[model samples]
Target: METVVMRVEELQLGKIVAEDIFANTQYPIIYKNAKIIHEHFRIFEMFNLKEILIYKEKKLEVLTEKQIEVETTIIKLSNYTSFETDYYDAIAQIKREFGNWQAGAKIDITKVRGMIIPLIEKVLEDRSYIFDLNSYSNAKDYLFHHCIATGLIASIISKKLGHDRGTIIQVAIAGMLADSGMAKVAPRIRDKQSALTEIEFAEVRQHPYYSYLLVKDLPALKEVMKVAIYQHHERLNGSGYPKGEKMSSITNFAQIIAVADVFHAMISERLYRLKQSPFKVIEMIKEEEFGKFDAQVVQALVDIVVDLPIGTKIELSNLELGEVMFINKYAPTRPLVKLINSGDIIDLAANRNFYISRVITKEY
Candidate 1:
């Protein structure tokens, strides 16, 4: 029988695989001639497999009609909401849920999945949304916004790290809920505008444990996800809270959320602290905070920020406008830039006093 290459998104139910599919495992993930089932979609996404060979159906007439429907879903971009709208709406939902949690309500996992899954899908569609997460945040709604953005950031980082779609979504959820335990803390402590007292700080640090309690009984959540929620605050160097877990004890999933949580928290504005530039914050995470995080997870975030295309407009720490002219392989963050006003090319690697403050425009 003749076979045709099909995009994984276009593959219909019951289609026969034309060849074995391997995702670097010792054995094939999907055997040749096996029928495609609903579960296989996740396997394909997990492996990031774009296209696969499938035997042509005996009835070409029915196949064409089915393929058209699949193609329509694939090509349609209008179905999704704008990233910002979906994002803020999710924040609002999380705010409500946090209130519910404070009122002694049980977690409604279905509702969380509904609000977050779309935001994740939209963000995954346009990876640039990750860059602007900090700008969308405010001090008043910082906690709510952080939860949603952390989930989105975690999802993208997980994707970059080559995790399956399901696992990526789980990591996003875990990252968002990592701080949910704060709802269990005293309101005065959580809402305090000034510095937290050492006693208050100690109580606040138990949020991760509270978070684990909130979701421990959830059957929909995997056991590893529950552990990640509890361990998101746990650092690789054993400096983190709840439990002082070292490198060997921490799970990769927890580390993904940990990096995402810190990245969003530092770049975002809060009552007690000023928001730092994303570029500057990333530098601190990679250098100053090096030993506390997983190297692979930190590198994934670095690649997302530093691997910018030339001609991307940006602002420097000195309030000067410029566009990226070239990227230095060694110091990806410190690229050569052309000053928008002065028309002079300065290599940021050599110019230690200046650094990227924010990306103005991504388009060339």
Candidate 2:
């Protein structure tokens, strides 16, 4: 870690002091190893301190440079353990359930709940599992990864919105079953790489209705659950197919699923296209899909994503590597990275050419 007297103009967010930064006033201590946030820039100047001793990286984060080795081991353990355990089976079941629905078997709400509840409990009890959700995205079968990621994402966003356990559980349940009706469409069309013809697009739009029909008759489902299934594809702009309902007509549960679905779809690899970076996708959701989706839901998703712990190793698009020095609230995908070889700190947001290509520990 470097210690230097940096001018006020050079200070940026998340700069931590190596030694105590004294002020003129009555405050007890501007203690050593204390981290500065966005609000502290003014506090430094208020005290009339023009320069302060700062470190190359903050010391207060739960993660540390020394601890990164252990965290990497833990991540490697997680991938193997989760793959062998029921985690893989849970996603496998989602795929099977979709096939069962298409085969004229009824929607088994009890079985679906049994599959979703354990995962929801895992994420709820430990929020760090949110980071693992992206790792769980696999390309072997889109629906398997899609449904599982959808549920985990739903619970996270639901809890962000302050929904109770019951609601969160239900949203999780709805998430797993949200796209089940895709089974009704021919696999060839669903996996088509090219733009769909008008007829194919029309067929694709019916999946939500098909999903609604499968779940609507299940007495085990709550009203909100059924509605989430039905309306997940409906947009506020009246551009969505089936009913083409507007903003006021859609329920909040559906809005949550809609956001999660779009996010999972974009991140997970598909036959049609390559996956985009999560940060870029989030930017698109906000900038392009404005009136088409609920803003609150999108913000909740963004809030949940930017919590990437410090010390995480990340890869850039050009194949260079770096470790996360700090998380920037203004831009998440573009966190402060201290390059391993150069020891130079980079603010990813400032450098537009380099976007985080992957989270090394979190992805294979």
Candidate 3:
């Protein structure tokens, strides 16, 4: 009998592999034509097995579950599909409340916090899909894309740092509301076309302080809420405002929020500036601003961005178009690509090889 196996993405469409049916009885099935899809299907079925063998090419052995827990965490991120509408409404409401906090009486920070926690857990359960911040739009949609993105990043970082559930939630909540003050800023300044003057910048910096004040009076929110509101802007270099806090003074929870905030801001398209490419932003964070961010946290973000599937169409450097096929973790900017019209994957990581030169520009 011919052995059959399916790809991970195909599992969602109900694809089946007849020959691999018997393999299901065993833990960690191996197949010559195995795909990550089989492992995902197994996960969807809630099978508590580890590892799946996809295929072996020359010296390369494709094992699907080395970091099984991490991979599983990534796969569960798809749950956001169900909560998109709720997220959208939550953001819209938050934005509106910021515009006129009195219009809605008092903003229900506790209620909003409750709604977002589960979403964060879902993303934590599946880190892979959720970490693909580049593919998501950061527009002014009512959806919780930003919250979800921040939550995912926070969860990943929290897990890496061995943070407990309570700590993780605190970080996630901070991430969700990091921009709550944006609503308080004048609409024109928030939506300005050109760079802001020193005054405008100062006003923007006041957001974190304003957010802190907004929640300072709530007893239930005294602990977690204040952290989220205040620390989102405190940076490592003491350059961040409201307070010029250095890394030593910054809380770990606050640091996580800062990374999430910066990452989301870079990937998201704003009214004044076009979105910065994820890989490019990662590189920038690593170089001149090295100590400004936690090195491990930045690496986690880079790993997530570099591993995006090859068939994903992306706007590239010099206005050329290509689809990512393979990622060079060491050099994310130069991933292997297959031109839109071409059929082969070009490994840009190969030095002086016939690969597309330059990085993916932010013009798109």
Write down the TM-score for model 3.
0.65
Which of candidates 2 and 3 is the stronger one according to TM-score?
A: 2
18-116 per-residue lDDT for model 1 (tens digits)? 897766443465778877755467567645799999889895333354554443212123423376787878888889999999999989999989888
Model 2, TM vs. native: 0.75
Weakest ten-residue segment in model 3 by summed lDDT: 21-30
Whole-model Cα lDDT of every candidate shown, in order: 0.83, 0.74, 0.58
Please provide, for model 2 over 153-198, each residue's C-alpha lDDT reduced to its tens digit, 9 standing for 90 to 100.
Answer: 8888999999998889889888878888888889888877689999
Stretches of candidate 1 exceeding 4 Å from the true structure: 1-81, 362-364
lDDT for each residue of candidate 3 in 1-364, tens digit (9 for 90 to 100):
3323434443322222333322232222223333344234533333333333233243433444454434332223244555555555555655555556533345576766766776676556555544345455565541245655675577667766777787777677666666665666777776676899999988988878766666666665547547756877777887776778887677767777778777776767765566666666766677856777767667766665565543445655445577654445457666656677655445555633333322332233
Clashes of 1: 0
Best by TM-score: 1
lDDT of 2: 0.74
Cand. 1 TM to true fold: 0.77
The candidate, 1 or 2, that scores higher on lDDT is: 1
TM-score order, best first, reads 1, 2, 3
